[model samples]
Target: MTGPIEGWAGPASLGEGSVLTVVGAPHPVLARLGDPVDPTDPAVIRLAADLFATMAVSPGCVGLAAPQVGVSAQLFVVDVGAHPKTATLHGSFALCNATVVEASRWRPGREGCMSVPDLTGDVKRASRVVVTGQLPGSGQSVTITTDAFEARALQHEIDHCSGKLFLDRVSSAHAIYQRKVYL
Candidate 1:
């Protein structure tokens, strides 16, 4: 049920979540690998909700990871539904301990991160991918096969969980561009 916008649902247990401040580049949390989280844990679920809330408020943010918010955990939330480049929409969902099991269709595309707000980079990434992870609240193991922008967004967040940034993926300084409009 990973097709279109059908499968994901934000868990009700999170309640009204408070949006946390997004930490920027040079933050130590963003540099270190995130600790794996127990998906069903109350704190993890709350963190997922906060990530969703923070992403919703931040303009042009398609995904957000725990490290970006100063949490050192393998948790993130994604929703590229509103972007013009989005192909497959998963609605909005939070994943814990996510990993990409399969990927192909490599292509270079412009990417920006909430943590690195001042720059955007041309990163080579898979346009199609198969990702596996557990849902935040239910802790249900799920596999998602997606393509286009959705795939790119997933990979970006996964990299964040892995202590890597789009800056690390760029071929060189020539591939990075300063963002004129912070969107």
Candidate 2:
């Protein structure tokens, strides 16, 4: 199950390990999409923290993945609730080896990507999703069912871990738009 179709541009380059990279793509090692993590490991925890920090500083970013920051690891952070206009996400989720177990058969929505900057496209995605992942520090598996904007945000970030850019999944380029000003 996938939600509406969206598109993004390619090769948003920043400083090395500055949260966006093109070299990270096409590297098979970068696509360890979902693998378990030892939550207690300080490095893992720090990685999650750094991801969150990066996300906070990034413009219009709702989520981020380790690979986006030039770290090939199964880690990502998401917080849909950070902005007022969007539906609130339940704070931050430091996910490791996150997997979608279920998804809703519903209409698709628009999406964008930090790695693929300046372009937004219509993409089909699961309107709702049930995801399972490990939470940092607890080493416990947690499941979350989300829909609408939140679901879209999660799917986009997770795609980065698998080297799947939003542009790859876009249903059409017709809806692509320029982000004139990012707040």
Best by TM-score: 1
Expressed as tens digits, the lDDT of each residue in 1-183 for candidate 1 is 244333445645565678999999999898899999998898998899888889889988999999999999999989888899888777788889999999999999999988998899999999999999988887888888899999999999999999999999999999999998734
Whole-model Cα lDDT of every candidate shown, in order:
0.89, 0.67
TM-score of 2: 0.76
Q: Which portions of model 1 show Cα errors greater than 4 Å? A: 1-8, 11-13
lDDT, model 1:
0.89
Where's the lowest-lDDT run of ten residues in candidate 1? 1-10
* Leading candidate by lDDT: 1
Off by over 4 Å in 2: 1-36
